[model samples]
Target: MTDYDIIIVGAGPAGLCAAIETGKEAKVLVLDRKQEIGCPKRCAEGLSLRWFKKMNLKPKKEWAVQEIKGAELYTPNGKSIKMKAKKAEGYVLERKIFEKELAIEAVKKGAKILMKNQVIGAEKKDNEIELIVEENKEKKKITCKIVIACDGVDSLTAKMLGLNTKLDLKETDSGYQYEMTGITGYDENLLHLFFGTDIAPRGYIWIFPKRKGTANVGIGIGAYEKETAKYYLDKWIKTQDGLKNGSIIEVNAGVIPVGGFLEKMQADNLLVAGDAGHMVDPIHGGGIGIAMEGGRLAGKHAIKAIKENKFSEKDLSEYTKEWYKLSGNDLKRRLKGRHLLEKLTNDDFNYLVDSINVEEALRIGNGTLTKKDKTILFTKKLITRPKLLKLMIEYARD
Candidate 1:
């Protein structure tokens, strides 16, 4: 048997971030099921640069494939609105390279990583947690003072800990993406989003440009939809001039839990971060940034608990408290906005686009509307459709 101060499952952004932080002051081990770190990419790979700055990390050119200056939103009727940021541009990354770099950074900070290893079971005994793992075709047990579950959406670690990891069909989104090259007639510096029932059902379609001639084209639909994501994606692609002749270089599919963060993320001697904890943004489906933030905060609090020699749920409550302080309210409001948007029809989307400019539309779509912005939008909606005032009031309360 081997032992370590901390053991993290998954080698994605969140797990590696936790390992890097915890390894600075304690023995840390990270386990991933993949033979190589960051294998089988499953993300759109679009992230804002602000997250990098927030973590005090620099964006490396090696993994950053393209810089995005702005985004365009398209309604079902083909009406379009464009929003451009003056600064803090987003980037399309090679996720495989980015995740590997994170793992490499964690390893450089004295963390040990076991690739091709998976945790099959976890149990709490005495003051430590024991993990049963299958490594290199051998079953082994390892003990650790604390365990951080950063596994993906279908997290066995969270389930083993007896946490409520259940996700309703409505709360999850089925997503599929294709990396296509030999594309033309696309603004390489702009990301595009198409919204409508026909385009993506209750969800949306996104085109995130990678290199000059390549882009990640994907569709995410609410799990209640009967059709598969690939079906909608293929149908939408046939109508796009740029992607009609594009050759698919890669295909990836995954699920995203858009239900906001879990109510509780910590139990006795254990903490859950990343998608496993449902840290995804319910409105935008952006989770990479939130995952890293959750991991860093969890790792920091874990170190504090280690120093105090206290691992009870009460002692670890600080992680949940601090994490909510960081993003709790924002996520709640976003979830409310998402629910409200789902009630809108294609005509409603078209009306919204025709009524507002790019900046105002973006503010509404991104759920960053100020109180004054809300009041104005509400007044306009009330004037146009009196029945919607009740729903607007409900959304405002959220």
Candidate 2:
């Protein structure tokens, strides 16, 4: 049996970030089921530079493949709106490389990492958490003062702890992506987003360039769609001149939890971060930044609890409180916005694209519109579409 101050169940960005923070003053150990870190890649790999700046970290050249200057949004009627801003510029990363670098940083901070290990069960004993893990085809027991479940959307740790991480079908998006080579006619410094019922049903399609000649072409569909993501992605790819002849070098698929952050992310001696806690952006499906933030916050509070020698649910509630203070309102607004969007029809989207300019579209996407801006936009929209306005009001109240 092995023991540590903290044991993280997943080796993704969130788990690694927690280890890096907690390892500063606590004995931290991270475990993953994969033999190698960042394997079986399953993300679009786009990250905003704003997050890196906010985190006081520099963009790593080795992990970055392309710098994005802006994004183009295409409506159902083929009208496009381009959005560009200093804060919106980002990078398309090689996620495998990025995740590995995070793990290396955590180790450098004195965190021990054990790959090819899966935590099968967890139990609370006194002030410590006992974890049953499978390593090398054998079951092993490890004890820890605290456990952070940074596991992905289907987190077994959260389930073991009896946390309500259940996601309704409507709250999740089925996503699929193809890393293609020999692709042409794409702006290497820009992202393209296509929205239409025919293209992606209730969700959207995205083209995130990785390099001059390669890109991560993907589509996400709401669970309400009967067709699979691959079907829609393939259908859209056929209509694209640049991607029709491109060769797929890699394929990745995953579920994105966009329901909103879980109301509760902690239990005695345990904290849940990342997708397990549903920290993903409801509108854009961006999670890497939020997941890391959650992990860092979890680590900070966990350390505080350890120093006080208190590992109760009440003691760990500080993590949830702090996280809400930082991002709670923003997340609530996003959920409201997503709900409003879900009520729109194809024609409604077309009307919106025709009515709003690039800057307005960007503001909506970034959720940076001022109250006055929204009032003006909504007043004009309501005059033209009273039914939609009623639905928006309903969503807002909800």
Candidate 3:
């Protein structure tokens, strides 16, 4: 048995961040099932630089796949609008390099890294958690004072521990993306989004450029009872311009929990970070920042629990509290917006595209909402129609 003060499963951003923080205060062991670190990337790799600036972290040269100035949004009717940010907009990260750097940072801080180790299950007894990890046809046990489950969306650890991981179909977004070369259209380093039922059906399509000639183009659909992301992606690709002439470099499928943050995200001597805790922004489907933030909080709280010699569920709730304190209201507001999106018809969205043009022209003259730079844009139906807003208010209030 290998003993550690804290054991983190998964080597992605959340897991690596947790390992980094925990290793500073205690002996930490980090494990990943994958043989190579950060190979076979799963994300669209877009991240806001604003979040990194606030954390006082600088992106290395390898981290930048491209620098972005802003984003352009397209409604279902083919209407488009572009928004440039006042500050540096974001980065399209090289996830392979980004993930590897996190592991390197953890190793620099004295955490042990185990590659190709699959944690099949864990046992909890006497206030300690014993993890069963498999590597190369051999099984091993790792005992630790606390377990941080930073596994991605479909986490076995959370399921095995009896945490509520069930997602309402309406609350889940099924997504598929392709990495491609020879992509056309100008590389503004701008992320492009296409929204409407016919296009994405309660979800949306995105194109995030990583280089001059390469991009990650993907689509997501609301989790309907019988539909899968592949089905939606296939249908959507046929309608995209850049992808029509491009060849697929790689493909990825993943689920995002966009309904809202988990009502509960902690258990006895354990904490869930990232998608396992449903920390993604409901509106944008961007999660790395929130996931890293959750990982940081989980690491700090785990250190506190170890120092206090208490690993009760109650003690672990501190991470939950801090996560909510940091991200709760934002997620809630976005969830409200997301729910409104689910109810919108394609025609409604089209009407909205025309309405926004009117509103933008009017705002330019008076400079009211346009002056403030509409952070959240409600469609014409949501604004002109009181009934829809009332419905959204009711849903949000619940």
Name the runs in model 2 displaced over 4 angstroms: 85-88, 363-371, 395-398
Candidate 1 residue-wise lDDT, 1-398, digit = tens: 23998899999889999988988898899998888776687689888877877777777788888889888888899877777777648888888999889998899999999988999999999999999999777999999988999988878997897677777778899999999999888788889889998889889999899988899999888988978999999998999998999999999999998874578889989898988888888887878888998888889988998899898888888898888889766787678788988888888778767876666665765677788877787886556865556666676664
Per residue, candidate 2 scores C-alpha lDDT tens digits across 1-398 of 23899999899878989998988799999999888887777688888888887666677788877889888888899988776656538899888888899998999999999999998999888778889999988999999998999989879897887677878788899999999999998778889899988888878999999998899999888987888999999988999998999999999999999875677789889899988888888888888888889898999988998899888888888888888888766887787778778778989889877876766655665566767656877787666788776774465443
lDDT of 1: 0.85
- Candidate 2 accuracy as TM-score: 0.95
The per-prediction tally of clashing pairs is: 0, 0, 0
TM-score leader: 1
TM-score for candidate 3, please give it: 0.89
Off by over 4 Å in 1: 86-88, 365-368
Query: Model 3 Cα displacement at 387 (Å)?
Result: 5.2
Q: Model 3 RMSD to the real structure?
A: 4.2
* lDDT (0 to 1) per candidate: 0.85, 0.85, 0.78
| TM-scores for every predicted model | 0.96, 0.95, 0.89
Residue range 1-398, candidate 3, lDDT tens digits: 33999988888888888888888789999888888877777678898987787545687768877888888888777778777666567888988988888888999998999999998988887888988899998998889988888888767887676677666666788889998888788555688888877667778888888888788888777777356777777777776686778888888878888865677788887889988788888877888888888888899999999889988887778778888888866687667766766787877667655655655533422324441334334443356766545654454343
Give the Cα RMSD of candidate 1: 1.6
In candidate 2, how many clashes are counted? 0
Please give the range of 10 consecutive residues that has the lowest summed lDDT in model 3: 364-373
* True-vs-predicted CA distance for residue 4, candidate 2, Å: 0.3
